[model samples]
Structure formats: structure tokens, C-alpha cells
Target: MLIDIFHDTVCPWCRIGKKHLFDALAKWQEQEVHIRWHPFLLDDTVPAEGYEFRNFMQNRKGIKAEELQHLFDYTQREGEAAGVKLDFEKIRLAVNTKLAHQLIALAPTNIKNDVVEAIYRAYFEEGLNIGDINVIVAIGTAYQMNATELKLQLNDRDVVDAVVAESAFARLNGINSVPFFIMNNQVKVNGSHSVEVFLEALNSTALLDIPAKI
Candidate 1:
């Protein structure tokens, strides 16, 4: 089975949703599964330097700072339940994620998911500016990717266009949200679903291939 995940690095729910999907995979050991990550830029117009995280959320949601805290509190609890940490208070910027997505695209298949998680951890947990080229270069190098070559590729015009185009392709396909999943190119699930929902999708697809599993 193949799972294509459309997500932006800065989305807190996307991180939680990723954990849920992996949790389901842990139980569904009946078939080999491959995952492909795709970019879904939440706000593509964000400047390269990024926007102030608190103000951006407040304006985008039309909610007061305290009200936003309430929402974040709920999300934090949900993230904890999902075994993922989401420190909203620590975040300072809503970064332009095109470069981050490019790094994920450049990563080898085996280490791609790890690279994705590292980006999430850096932005959400450590409050690092992932939009910065130096930060991304460091991340790539930490994973044993060639630092100088990775830096060059990250700055290449073609790579930027490729990541941007991939994001556009998602919007063209009517996928305007993060954490969207397509299982076996048949099951379409949106939002941050529970582990059971993911398992249901996995089992349904697995049954099609191995009918006698029950």
C-alpha cells in the first residue's frame, strides 16, 4: 500500500496526524507500505523572512490572543494524547515552507520521513527559523547529506520551482488542506483523523490484496 501525505511543516495538527498514521502502521503488519510526502503550503504568499507567528494566527483566525491560547491548549492536549509535543508558545514565526519542502524532496527515501520530523521538531519545538537557508543546510548535513551540495541545491531556481509547483498541483487537485491522505490512490481522508480511522483505511486496502486475512 502507498500513502501520499500532503502537509506543511509548520502545521501542529499535521505532526499529530503523522504520529497517528504511524501508530496505525505499527499494528497493520500485513502488507508492505510506502509513504510519499507532498507539499501543501498553508500560505504561499508568506515572505521569505516569514510572519510573526502570534499576529499571523490572530489575524488569520480572527481570534484574540487569549482565545488563541484556548485553542492552542486544546491542541496541545490532543498532541500529548497522540504522543507528540506541540509548544505553540515557543513558535515565533510562520515560516515560508517552500525551502523546507525542498529539503524533504532532496532527502533519500529511507531518511525522508526523518527529515520531515526534524523540520517539524525544529520549528514547533525549538522555535528555529526554518525559512533560513543556514538552518536547512544544517539539518541536511546532520542527516549525512552533503552540506555544500545540499546548500547549492536548496538555492537552485529549479528546486524552488519544483517545490512550488508540487504545492500548486495539490491545490489544482482540490486539496487545500494539510494532513490529507490518499491510501492506495483510492481512500481519501482529510483532517487529523484518529488512529482507528487510519487503521480502517489500511485494513480496507489490505483486504483487497489479501482477501483471506480475516
Candidate 2:
């Protein structure tokens, strides 16, 4: 089975969904499952320098202070339950994740999940600015990727365009949300579903002879 996950690095729910998917995989009897990561920019218009997290939420999303706090609190509780420790207060910047997605794209299929997990941990858990080239380089190096090559690729217009194109393809398919999962290109599951839900989908897809999408 091939699982293509359409998600953004900054999405807290995406992180949770990743954990749920992995948990399901751990219990799955099948050993031939392949997972692919696809980019979805939550805020594609964000500047390269990004914006202060609180200000962006308030000014752009029009979220008031109390309401924002409630939302963060709820998300943090859910994250903890999903084994993700997101430090909302420590996150100062809401970054543009195009570069991060490009870095993940550079990784081999086997290590792509590691790259994605590192990006999520740096942004949400450590509150690092993933949009910064230096920070992205450091994350790639820590994952044993070539730092100099990764830095050069990050600045390359072609690589950036590829990531943008992938996002466009996702939108063309009517995928407007993060954490969207497609199994074998025949079954689609959206949002941060439970581990049981993912397992059920995996099992069901294995048993069905659904025609592959064109």
C-alpha cells in the first residue's frame, strides 16, 4: 500500500495525525506499506521572515486573545494526548514552511519521515524558526543530510518551485485541508483521525479491489 500524506509542518493536527498513522503502522501486519509526504502550505502568503505568532493569529486570522488562548489550550491538551509536546507559548514565529518541505523532499523515501518529524519537533516543540535557512540547514545536518547541499538546494528557485507545484497539484485535487491521507490512491481519509480509524482504513484498502485513480 502507498500512503500519501498531504500536510504542512506548522499544523499541530498534522503532527498528531502523523503519530496516529505511525501507531497504526506499528500494529499493521503488512510490511510492504510505503508512505509519501506531500506539501500543503497553511499560509502560503507568509513572508520569508514570517510573522510573530500571536500577531499573525490576531491580525490575519482575527482571533482574539481569549479565544486564541482557548484554542491553543485545547490543541496543547490534544497534542499531549497524541504524544506531541507542543510549546505554544514558546513559539514566537509562525514560519513559512516551503523550505522545510523542500528539505523533506530531498530525503530518501526511507528517511523522509525522519525529516518531517524533525521539522515538526523543531517548530512546535523547540519553537525554532524553520523558515530560516541556517535553522533548516542545522536540522538537515542533524539528520545526517549534507548541510552545504541542503543549504544550496534551499536557495534554488527550481526546488522551491517544485514544492509550490506539489501544493498546487494537491489543491487541484480538491484537497483544501491538512492531514489528508490517500491510501493506494483509491481511499481518502481526511483530518487527524484516530489510530483505530487509520488501521481500519489500511485493512479495508488491502481487502478492496478499488480501481486506481487516473
Candidate 3:
């Protein structure tokens, strides 16, 4: 089974939703699944330096800081229930995700998930400025990639265009939210779903067989 996940790193729901999906995968360890991480930038118009989370949410959602914080707190609780550690207070940056998406595109198919998780943790948990070249370079280095070469590739016009094109395609397909999961090229599941939902989907596709674990 192939699962194409369209998500943004800084998106709280995306982060939480991914954990749920992973938990489902882990629960069904006998299943052989190939997961692909795709680009889906929530704030594609935001500058490279990004914006402060509080300010961006207030302006975009027309809500106050308290309300946003409450939402974050609720999300954090859900993440924790799924054994995901969400560092809400640590996540301070919200930059343009064009470059991050491009990097994901350039990565080898085998290591794409590793690279995606690293970027997500860096921005949401470690509070790193993921839009900065230096930070991206370090992230690439941590993944044993050629940082200098990646820095050079970051300027490629094709890379930027590809990310934008993917986002537009997703929108055209009725994807108005992040963490959208497309399974087996036919199942279009939007938003973050629970582990049970994913497991049921897997079973329906005959991609998973559940047996007693003792």
C-alpha cells in the first residue's frame, strides 16, 4: 500500500495526525506499506523568514492569543494521547515552506521520511528557523547529505516551481487542509484521522492482517 501524505511541518494538526498514522502502522507491524511525504504549504505566501505563530494565527483566524493558545493546548493533549511529544511553547517560527518542500522533493525515496521528520522536529520542537539556509544546511548535514550541494540546489527555479505546482494541484483536488492522506491512489482521506480509521482502511484494502499478539 502507498500512502501519500500532504502536510506542512509547522502545522500542529499535521504533526499530531502523522503520529496517529504512524501509531496505526506500528500496531499493524505485519503490513508492508510504502509511505511518501509530499509538500503542502499552509502559508505559502509567508516570507522566507516566516512569521511568529501567535501573530499569524491571530491575523489569519481572526482570533485572540488566548483562543489560539487554548487550541494549541487541546492539540497538545491529543498528540500526547497518541504518544507524540508536542513542544507547543518551543515552536516559535512560521516561515515559508517552499524550500522545505523542495528539499523533500530532492531527497532519495528511501530517506524522505527521515528528512521530513527531522524538519518537522526542528521547526516545531527545537524552535529552529527552518527558512534559514544555515539551519537547513545543518539539517542536511545531520541526514548525511551534502550541505553545500543542497545549499546550491536551494536556488534552483525548478525546485521552487515544483513545490508551488504541487500545492496548486492539491488545492484543485479539494485539499483545503493539511495532513491530507491519499491511500492506494483511490482513497482520499482528508484531515488527521484516528488509528482505528487508518487500520480499518488498511484492512479493507487487504494490506494488513491482524492476529493475536502475545
Candidate number of the best lDDT: 1
For each candidate, the alpha-carbon lDDT, in order, equals 0.90, 0.89, 0.79
Report the Cα lDDT for residue 129, model 3. Answer: 80
Ranking by lDDT: 1, 2, 3
Task: After the best TM-score superposition of candidate 3, give how far the Cα of residue 160 lies from its true spot, in angstroms.
Answer: 1.0
How far off is residue 166 in model 3, in Å? 0.7
Residue runs of model 3 more than 4 Å from their true location after superposition: 207-214
Worst 10 residues of 1 by lDDT: 205-214
lDDT by residue (1-214, candidate 1, tens digit) is: 7888999999988999999999999998877778999999888889989999989999999999999999999999999999998998889888899989999999999999999999999987899999999999899898999998998899899999999899999999999788999887777889889999999988887666633211
User: 188-211, model 2: which lDDT tens digit per residue?
Assistant: 889998999999999889888554
- Model 1 ranges with Cα > 4 A deviation: 210-214
Instruction: Enumerate residue pairs that collide in model 2.
Output: none
Better candidate by TM-score, 2 or 3: 2
lDDT of 3 by residue, 1-214 (tens): 7778999877877877888888888887655678877788787788877788779878888999899889888988887787767787886767888877778888887888888888878877788888887887787778788987898888889888988998888899888888888777666667778989877776665543333122
Given candidate 2, what's the lDDT at residue 36?
84
- How many backbone clashes can be found in candidate 3? 1
